[model samples]
Target: MPSPNYFKPSHPPTIANVPELTPYYYDNSIRMSPMERAFFTKIAKKDKSGMVGGSDEAQFFRLLMHATGAKKALEVGVFRGSTTAYLAQGVGDGGKVIGLDITKDYLDEVDAEEFWAEMGVADRIEIRVGNAVDGMRKIYEDENGSGTFDFIFIDANKDDYDAYYEWALKLVKPGTGLIAVDNTLFHGAVLDKNHEEGRAIDTLNKKIHADERVESSMLCISDGVSILRKK
Candidate 1:
């Protein structure tokens, strides 16, 4: 059985129930530049996977970056570069966002480099194509065996969540850096007995909860997001 608190909502989802409030709420709270707006629209029209992070979730990421004063970030998944663009924007001038993906096909399809240039964040974003684990390990070694990132976002294959978290600890600054994992609730599938991805996510969720090296909170923002701050 799944943990009782696993699927609980962090807050009421009135807007979720009422779809009309989506645009209204986003217009009022989330600010997107013209380039960002164009990029989202382009992705929606072209990409059919629907894997892009939602507006509220993107806003939460931006807020987290601002709150932590994060200048360096690492993103484990770079799906179509939507969230990567948001990460770049969040880090601001002279900041850097390292994005890792299993393939370069999606990044090419989205013309990510050109888009980043238009957004004036080309220098701040670097796309590393290959296995995420290997890329993360290289980053750790390159940092001279010390934590170098202020923030890390993991949203890759669910089965590899634990591995990503383990590496994230080595890459993040203790007591200050934040590690945010997406889709922890897995669309409430964590309650299903036979769902492989859900089971993997649930395992990581429990592990994070009991981890003495970090302070954690699980919020049901979009599918579910778990934030961990290492001590």
Candidate 2:
């Protein structure tokens, strides 16, 4: 159900972004698969920025897949294929995942082929390195206008999020399909309306909120996640 906005708050609601809260929450939450834990540990150790989604958020992707019983999924960004692994697992047996990335640099850095194989999901996933929009366009074209995906995840170039969402709407199954956009809040930048990416995300958030074709919500999760279901 969509969140109700019936009452106006007298005081501004406090948003939580404490550093210690992560460890505390992860400690009490459900444990990730051993492979997910190891791969995430590697990402956290080698990737200084920690841009990749954390275990809990990654698990949420898997949860979304299960919730919708998604058999075919698309991930728009494949940074080191960390979250891609979870997406692959989420699709269950005989399912497929298409991963699109702007470059193979990160995948090469991590030996993605061997990594996905080690994760036991190599055969079910396909990696496409190029412009994400073009890749999605090809998929839509190849699928003959009919929605070819049950789930689509967008975590690519923030500036192009609106474009990606437009394409995703065309590719995902109507009513049943789900589209998830990451970093919707952009580190709280959406609230301040600073920078190009933040402004882009803010615009999309508002558009999705008002868009009558889909039902959506912005979750206050890691960096903020927005889920949209086509009507």
Candidate 3:
């Protein structure tokens, strides 16, 4: 069974109401609690990909890894390394996580080394720069020589999803391997019918469902995510 749908809000709440209910991500904009808030607040101040994954999304990585015992894991995006740290928390000590991204430098303003150290699981992550699909290929090669991965998170460019899906599947075992695709809901626009991202995701979701290699479920969480586990 897949996680409950939360991102595709039947009727999105208002931010200016008496209770001031903002969007799922909007609530994180304001910070408190000193260090934890400071870290997130710093990411919020940026306009670029400095902080990509919100807490809810990061928790997806953490919980899924925990549930799957994903010692050998892969992430197709590494913006600012915030999500990387979250995965590190899930696969700690003897476990390892491979994170890849196209960008060489993200949030260079922040102290990357110190932040991971503060998180205390810095040693388990390996970051690489290249096309995410290409990076997925490298992990396949690594596993061919070593062992298979337990899980993979696909949060790279949405346009290349089909290619990433093909490559990521090769790195894990069928029926046990887990894959999650980000931005599947495409911001409530999947209902719009004419929007580009929505149309593309709608088409892709159909293909994913029909594919014999996996059983998939789309969650309305943090931009419409889909979780797939090989059948």
Candidate 4:
């Protein structure tokens, strides 16, 4: 069973009172490629775990990559590679995306490599399956200490957020890289004291706010996305 505070609002009461979405907003704001649309449909049909982020979140990630001119990216949780596809699209043919997941089942289930090839980005992504912390370390070492990525997306296990943040800081470019973390709000469970996953997220949120190395903001976008730009 879930805790009572699982769905409680973390935002102020006034803000929480606002409608979740409006027709005007939905009609005018979102955009997706045909490939992206297909990916969404595929996930809807196959992904029963509900691990994928909404289209808005995926689009935001792509926008951030384009806005930053991110040529090299790292995605901590590849899930079904939906976000990876978006990242690849944002970076173009010359860029690359390094994806890490704890298991290969999701990647295989989604036929990620085949999809990337179909999208004309197979050469741009390298999928690694194992402990993300170890993978990040290997990546740092393999790049000869200079493979700093321009953008990073973290959406892995909530308990490892702090550890991931530490590695993300090390892997990202010192001044311009962006690190975006998904599920910081955890379905508003962050308000609950007893939820371990929520507590993990809440801890990372506080840490990011206090950390002087980055400028940060938490948006109410799908499940909440916390974006940090390194100083």
Candidate 5:
């Protein structure tokens, strides 16, 4: 079910320049009670920043998983497993997610078993270390792999998004597959011609929008996200 406070598409909430509002957004979207919010607030206030999985981007992934009944998922950047656990639980124990990260610094901050125990769906999660491309390749070449995924979240290095998208394209089947790219808006920098990040994301957006291989929607939510459903 959609959270009661889900900021509508027409009236999207603006993210601040810092991670100050991120904790609030994360707890808010989880639909927690006041006490629960306080608990998360404590953890969030101690957060100095650069925590990847707790961003609003994670909310988008969770909704996508539920909306499309996505049982198989791939997260290119798994920082602290915040989004990984969220995605894994949303689809339940029957689903699986390949959590790929270049390093485990953020993931090691919290105990995986403890986190998964709370989620009640930890068995479905798989953690992999390496670059996104290598991790993706390993999954595809697995002997018992289906070579098919219901959803793929590209939140890795900005420079490698294009490569990730291209690689993911070959592994999906039409109609039931969803590919979502995060940080495409680059915190509204994409609108400024002076920002290099803007130019890079702008280029990716146009390319995917024009591609006939998939049907797409560009959502301005949380740093700008582009969602493509394989045609």
Candidate 6:
């Protein structure tokens, strides 16, 4: 009863075809737009670290922008500008995303400028290459030391997360701005208390939990994203 094509070497089945990868997730997941898929594919091929956020996570960022009506956003880490692109889309026309990365090597490798141009959001993105803290500080100072950002995302080095949070608190709008910290779970290492990176995140988590200036939630999305809304 086998068909002639039964043993044929066809293209690999993805979530669109094989819903069995994670039945519940695949069944209910929101599908990526064509542009999003292309960007994701490009990053998957170029990024050796495999650290890019998943489509779901990227969608969450976009949703956050839409929900908050955020026009000005900042991303502390700009690895290949994958999430940066989503953030740019979330901000919409006339909005801006300030991306800070330690190096432009990854961005250059991925032809980020060309891709962003192709997506029609190149003008909305501003890339600053330098030490994260220094870059953030410069942004903070350039704006005359006031909280001006509607949203700020932190995904840089774990050791500097606390410092990044400190600056984020200073840069985001008061009483309404949102701050998102990625990798808060540190791959469940925070639970085991065995990893140095995990310990650092745990420390920051406790600090954020205790801080009264923001209402926070630890969303169990990709790698655990902790979102804080300034009060």
**Top model number, TM-score:** 2
lDDT by residue for model 3 over 29-125, one digit each (tens)? 4333354455566667777643376667777768888987778778888777777777887786798888888874673555554677777777888
In model 1, where do residues sit more than 4 Å from their true spots?
A: 1-24
lDDT of 2 by residue, 1-231 (tens): 323672535433333535656667778875766766666666666654367865677788899898889989999988888878888888988999999998878877667677778889888899898999999898888857458789899999989999999999999999899999999888778877558888999999999999999999888778889999999
Residue 166 lDDT, candidate 2, scale 0-100: 96
The digit string of per-residue lDDT tens for model 1 on 62-168 reads 88898889999999998888888878888999999999999878877878778888988889998888999989988878756358899899999899999999999
What is residue 51's positional error in candidate 6, in angstroms?
Answer: 1.3
Per-model clash counts, in order, read: 0, 0, 2, 0, 0, 0
Q: Report the C-alpha lDDT of model 5 over 161-205, residue by residue, as the tens digit.
A: 778888778666568888888887786777788877678777788
How much is 106 displaced in model 4, in angstroms?
1.0
RMSD of each: 3.0, 3.2, 5.2, 4.8, 6.6, 10.1
Return the clash pairs for model 3, or none: 7-220, 185-224
CA lDDT scores, all candidates in order: 0.86, 0.83, 0.71, 0.84, 0.71, 0.85
List pairs with backbone clashes in candidate 5.
Answer: none
- Which candidate leads the pack in lDDT? 1
Q: How many clashes (backbone atoms < 3 Å, residues ≥3 apart in a chain or on different chains) does model 5 have?
A: 0
CA lDDT for candidate 3: 0.71
RMSD (CA, Å), candidate 1 to true, equals 3.0
Per-residue lDDT for 72-148 in model 6, tens only? 99999998887898899889999999999999999888888888888889999999889999988988887664688
Provide the lowest-lDDT 10-residue window in model 2: 6-15
> What's the TM-score of every candidate structure?
0.88, 0.90, 0.79, 0.88, 0.77, 0.87
